[model samples]
Target: MTSSDRSPILPASAAAPRSDSEVERLHDLILSSLDDDQADEVVSIPLAGKSTIADYLVIATGRSTRHVASMANKLAQKIKSETGQLVRIEGLATADWVLIDAGDVIVHLFRAEVRSFYNLERMWGFGDNTDSTN
Candidate 1:
């Protein structure tokens, strides 16, 4: 299935469209920055009510503890340099999880095992909007 076939994995009242290029940039940055068992399983959850810090959430995983930190660093830098967005990262030391918070978007970088344990996508169930690559 393509991105057009997959839904956004968010709630109805709190959904919005974001650029496909931006998403691709983010996906590339994350993949290039980290090594992971599975990266495409990544999900970005809209947190309109869940957060006051950001409007949307992006969650991806790295293969190991070290990869998580590296991916977070590269992704954070990419966002900052490209968009001039301010970011705050958490849980980088252990690399179990690293959270990059950009005002409009929040990215969660996690170790694959840890990510599987958390199962974050379920928290942001999709409403009606389909995930389109366009």
Candidate 2:
């Protein structure tokens, strides 16, 4: 299914809408965590009106299964410790593709081949304006 059409594996947290700065802070935290972990090809897709699941969709790649798992684990811990927001993670067993649901930001971590196969960037119509990789 297309990323936009797929239902969140876990139900969204029932909380009041966050302010713009709050969401931006969370988004920035996620991106930085991934970057620090050496995530590659990171793309951030704004979902302000395109979807209700999250304010932003982050797609990234890791060199291998271990790398993907490590990134996902580190990201989850970082988000929780920094923002006190618990994130739900999936697909860590094989680590071919791991999904991190961080409230307003949804992260997808994949191995190089898996990332190319899913091509979430293309699925989400990512372009030059959407890339924020550092």
Best by lDDT: 2
The digit string of per-residue lDDT tens for model 2 on 5-88 reads 986554334445789998999889988888888888888989888878888999998999999999999988888898777788
- Evaluate model 1: give its TM-score: 0.60
Q: Model 1, residue 75: displacement in angstroms?
A: 1.1
Q: How much RMSD separates candidate 1 from the native structure?
A: 13.0
Listing every candidate in turn, what is its Cα RMSD in Å to the true structure after a full C-alpha superposition? 13.0, 7.4
Per-residue lDDT of model 1, residues 38-85, tens digit only = 444566565556665455566776777877777777777776677655
What alpha-carbon RMSD in Å does predicted model 2 have with respect to the real structure? 7.4
Best by TM-score: 2
Candidate 2, 109: how far from true, in Å? 0.2
Regions of candidate 1 where Cα sits further than 4 Å from its true position = 1-40, 47-53, 126-134
